[model samples]
Target: MSVNIMLYKITLVVYIAATILFLIDVLLRRTSLGNYARGTLLIGLLVHTATLATRYAEVGQTPVANLHEALSFFAWMLIGSYLLIDLRYRLDSLGVMVCPLAVIMLLAGGVIFYEVPHQNPMLDSWWFPVHVTLAFAGYAVFTLAFLVGIMYLLQERMLKTKSFSGLYYRLPSLDILDIINYRCLSFGFPLMTMAIITGAVWANQAWGGYWRWDPKETSALVTWFLYAALLHGRLNVGWRGRRAAIVAIIGFIFLIFSLFGVNLMLSDEHSFDAFKSLR
Candidate 1:
């Protein structure tokens, strides 16, 4: 009924249209549909931007205060990152996977309209949005890498097993996938590092200490270390192909645990209150 929800619905409709175009392109081998899908998705992103902006204006602060907000924001980050990567690589095939994932995230978030009574004063600072944006951006980049990794492995398996299929033809080459995975790693590490640094600074301001042994903090650190090791091996030790893809996939799992497992199943400063508590 509200303008924010209405804009969100419009964004979802646009995303679904783009996704349908992409699926048709994949199924019917219509190259023009891919370009149309990209344009449609870009429009959807603009609408999504409006949705978030309206929500922030309505809330008088950052909009990511609950599951509904966080999921929507995460979906936005994911789609934005995918678009950025696709821009560089011209990866039309990836849209098939990413668009559906974005739709699912939006739908799941839409299903839960949990809202808090009052905004947490800790989230009043600019650091809340900055840190969360950087962290979610990092998560988005790694997710793309993981998706590409899966594609790489699947392609490799098909080649080895000599079981050619339509999906194999649709997916990018293993080399391209691996190169993009490395690029994602290179981009995401810095974002994750910045997120941690900003989080520490914010923590110092809010909690009177930079380092807390809280569950979220510890899990983020662990996930960061995992990425660090992966990057180190990649740059210096020359890990590539199956090794890199497999490890990157594992890293994504760790990231999921760090981002969701700690916040949802476990309790901490970043538990999200399941969209509860102004205290």
Candidate 2:
């Protein structure tokens, strides 16, 4: 636990430094500093992983069964996705957006460290880990796609308006953003499907039903349907650019509402009591 705390402190510090460096790099147009920011981000990711591993070993289970663990996992997923995309593409500008988000998520996770000793009874099954992990992984990818879509729209708008501001210059081309958005969604969609299937199976085992209209479950279904529509529109309608980008943005908004808003605003078996305590 002491080691985990130290790792958490290190992650928080590195994430803050990375965010500052990325922001400065963007403002000053320093690509070299952006490389330094990426290295800082890598350090943060390593420390965060070590902390989670330690927690898992201490707990004798995957730590994600509790609110604090889930929130930590969410932060890790964000950084992990960013690292993968950054390695694959020259998306340093994206780090300027994502690094701050990672910092916020990690800090929030740290602040909400109230210990809920017992796991939720509903989440006691073997598939729980697979379901939750895949769901969060899919969410992470969608989050990246959402940010890229935003950049695409902004760049396209700037082009149409003939405004060549610093942001316009800093962002990638709309075409490139569109391609990145599609690639992220393509990778995320299959993982989301697997999550849904595993979740349904877990539901059947725990609740004697496969599909309860619980708020969380319903919201997830709606988000899934929205993304499925986006995918279909892209495939059947040959929607490959700005239009597809818009759909991705909408899908991500719905995903956030489903993941956070629904759990806070409504009641359901999947609601894990983090709502009342803000943990």
Q: Number of backbone collisions per candidate, in order?
A: 0, 0
lDDT (Cα atoms) of all candidates against the true structure: 0.88, 0.84
TM-score of each: 0.96, 0.94
Q: Model 1, which residues run further than 4 Å from truth?
A: 114-117, 275-279
TM-score of 1: 0.96
Query: lDDT tens string, model 2, 52-160?
Result: 8888767666677655677788889988998998897868889989888978877887787646446556666788888989999999999999999889888898999
Model 1 lDDT per residue over 105-186, tens place: 8998888763532668898998999999999999999999889989899999999999999988788888899999999999
How big is the RMSD of model 1?
A: 1.9
The local lDDT score (0 to 100) that residue 238 gets in candidate 2 is: 89
Clashing pairs in 1: none
